[model samples]
Each structure stands twice: as C-alpha cells, then as structure tokens.
Target: MDHLETWEQKGYVQFPGFLSETETNDLKEWVEQISSWPPDPEKWMHHFEQIGPIARPARTEYIIDFHDGLRRLLTTGKVPETAGSLLGQPVVLYKEKINYKYPGGGGYAAHQDAPAYEFVKLHITCSIAIHDATPENGCLYFAPELHREGLIHLNDQGCIEESKAKSLNWEPIPMKAGDALFFSSYAPHYSPSNQTDQSRRTLYLTYNALAEGDLRESYYADKRQAFADAEKTGDQRMRVSKIGHFNGKPPEQS
Candidate 1:
C-alpha cells in the first residue's frame, strides 16, 4: 500500500529485504552456477564484455527454463504476486536477466525500457540486488516521476539524448543484497561503470499484465534476430542488450 503510493508519486518503489538472507544466498549460488555454465547457445544466453585484456561475463538471460529454483522464485512466489499487485492485475513473465557488473564492467545510458520490450505497452521491472549495490558500484540512478511523461527525447540508439539525459534531476538508488526496486517500463534510468573491486550483480525480472498475452518467447526470438542482424551489419555496439542503451564493448571489439 505504502509502496504503491510511492510508485504513483515517484514512478518507482523500493522493497528492502524482499528476499531473506537464506533465500538471497540460494539465489546467489544459483546465479553463480548459471554464470559458470559454458555458453550454451541452444538454451540460456550469455553476453560478455572486454574488461582490460580479458573477456568477462556481463549478463545471462533466459534461465527460468533451465533452473527450477529461479523458475519458482520468479514465477510462483512474492515476486510475481507483488508485480501483479503493482500492475493491478494478474501478471505474466515478460523476460528475465541478470546483469553481472564485474569490476570495471560498463553501465547503461539513460533510457526507457519500453522501446526495446515490444508487444507490450506497459511493464513492471523488478531489480533484485544480488550483491550490495552502491553509488560506488554503479547502482542505478533514476529520474523521479518521469515515467508518467512517456518516452522522452529518445534517439536513434534507443536512449535518451545525452544532453537531455544530463538535464534531468537524477538520484542514485543504493540497495542492499536481497532488496528489490520496482519501476515502470517508462522509467528513465541509467548507471555508471563499477568503480569497486567487487562485482555488483542485479537480477531483473520484468512482467506484463496477463491480459496482454504471453510475449516472452516472441520477445527473445526477436531479440536473437536483432542481435544477428546487428552482427551482420557490423554494428560495433555492445551485444549485451537489444537496445543501444548499454555502454559496453561488443565482443568483436574486444
């Protein structure tokens, strides 16, 4: 209730300790397992970044089908329940991904997620912190109450124009492990490079109203094609996301 009120006024809400310490540890171990799995192009997807002379893991997605623990965590419990509550209807999974921001990993530019997530007009994304996230570790920064403005100054790269992004009043959201931050698809958000020696990981689970129809499979199918197209065109952007908002070195560039 209070969080819902905050969501209306700020376009985002934070739920501290959404996951208990034991649950957080389990999720972390599962993430470690997922991250360690060698790239299986047929199943889960992995993206890499060139940090220094070494290629490091940057992201992993499409894991719910592979890991039962994560599947249940994302699908059955409080996560989806809260998402449905926020959306004011039953919700269906749209997509899920874990951002592994290892030391020196890159951050995203200011952008609204709606442009990249197709087939749904509205969405709610919950960012569950897998590790302590702080301003020094590239935690996300957001512009309060901006989601109601719809898309703002979107550019060719699927991000807000840098000048426009800079002019917005932005605030950092530092969260402890197990904390969850929920925001609208239209929320204007960004982050900087991780300046710490440790990894700053976050699990992002996105959902749409059940009435919108299930678009998860279609979304990933299109994303794969989009990435393939970019590869064919020699697009030298980060391969981490479908959108150009990501600010990382593409695998080829590494």
Candidate 2:
C-alpha cells in the first residue's frame, strides 16, 4: 500500500522488516551496553540503575546519527516523494529521539505533536522499532480519523477528557523489530504501560516543512539543559529559556 494513503486511512502504517536482523541486533546491543554503563561512575555508584533494565539515555551522538540516517533515507526521493505527494512539498526532518519504556514505566499522556509547530498541516512521524513491541510491551495505540477533527486541548491533568468521553476506539499496533511505524503527528495517540518483563525500545523521527523564523529556540534550550542535567552529578537544576523567540518578546529579559 502507498504510505501516505495508509496513514490517512488508519492513522498509522507499519513497514515490516525495515531494517536487517543483523542491524537490529547490533543497535539493540549498543543500546543495552550504553544503558548498562553509568554516566558518572565515580560520583554515582550506579547511575545506570536509574535507567532501569528497560530504558536508555538519549545520547547526542545517537540522536545525531539517527537524524542524519533518516535524512538520507528521506532525501533518496522515494519515501519523501510519497510524502511530498501527500504534503504537497518537499519535507525536512526537524526532530528525532530514542524512546525507551521500561517495565512498569508509565504511559505517555495522549497528545498531538502538531501543536508544538506553527502553521502547518499533514506532518509525519516515523517510529522504528528496535525491539519487538507487543501489547504487553507497550505498543502504540491510536484512533483513526482523529486528525481530521483538529487539535483538542488537554485539561490540567494532561488528559484529553473530551476525546476519552467520546466513543473513541483505539487500535493497538503490534510490531516486530525492524518494522517502521509511520503516522500523522496530529493524530491523538499514546502508548500503554509496559506490563511485560522486557522494555520497549524505539527510535522516533519527525519530519515537517522548514518554516522561516526561530520559534522553538526556547524549547531547544530546554532540551540542551535536559542534556546537560543528564551529565551532572547532583540534583539537576531545571533551566528556563531566557531567549524570546517563542512569545514575541526580545531575546533578553525586559
């Protein structure tokens, strides 16, 4: 099936065997080894322990490589060609991350990724499974046709109560290692808790139009601080964005 049409109909499409078995195993081993090593062995006896057996740190190197690899894949004019057919323009990868959910790890609250961007429609998110994702292992779940309705606001509890209250049916996507899941980021979706013994590992990469102006500088600064905090020894201090690209204020505090 064509990729974008599948996504438009089902809210997501799974490409099985997207990566080779050897490559999958190699990436899995790399993640496992990295997750086992302590960030600062001298200061913390077992900082890796905090990561749990199910999750790993999102290292800058890994993220950069992942982004570059995906960019190359999209630039091949195959997948992006299809994407352009859907979006009506060439697409650019804007964000990428590794998402690892450990056993008993809490689920992500249902939300849309479109709100984070500005003046855009029909963006895409491609999530590659690094491990077998079963219902017990917290596979992704989503409601089809939700994206067409537009973004809904979440309440204080971070729950979309109105959508939940509606007769919304969620379809669980069970995917194997090497399968790539593609979906519209505007769709309301979330992964359930990892009830099994093993962790759910995935590489999530997002693509959108390259818009003019710097709107997410503050968000990126927050991300930079998050990265910095992960390297620090003591209780990490949360950093606020002093830059003003987000809300029409100056770069410096008034």
Best lDDT goes to which candidate? Answer: 1
Model 2, 1-254: lDDT tens digits are 68667777776777788768976786677556545555452221111112334232322112333234444654455455544555556666555555566666545556666665444454777777888998887888877777777766655433455556255687888899978877776677767667887878886666665443222333444455554675484422211111111111111212
The residue-by-residue lDDT of candidate 1 on 201-242, one tens digit each, is 999999999999999999999888887888799876638776
RMSD of each: 1.2, 8.7
Off by over 4 Å in 2: 33-62, 65-86, 117-122, 157-159, 162-166, 211-219, 225-254
TM-score of 1: 0.97
Best-matching candidate per TM-score: 1
Candidate 2: worst 10 consecutive residues by lDDT? 241-250
Q: What residue pairs are clashing in model 2? A: none
Off by over 4 Å in 1: 252-254
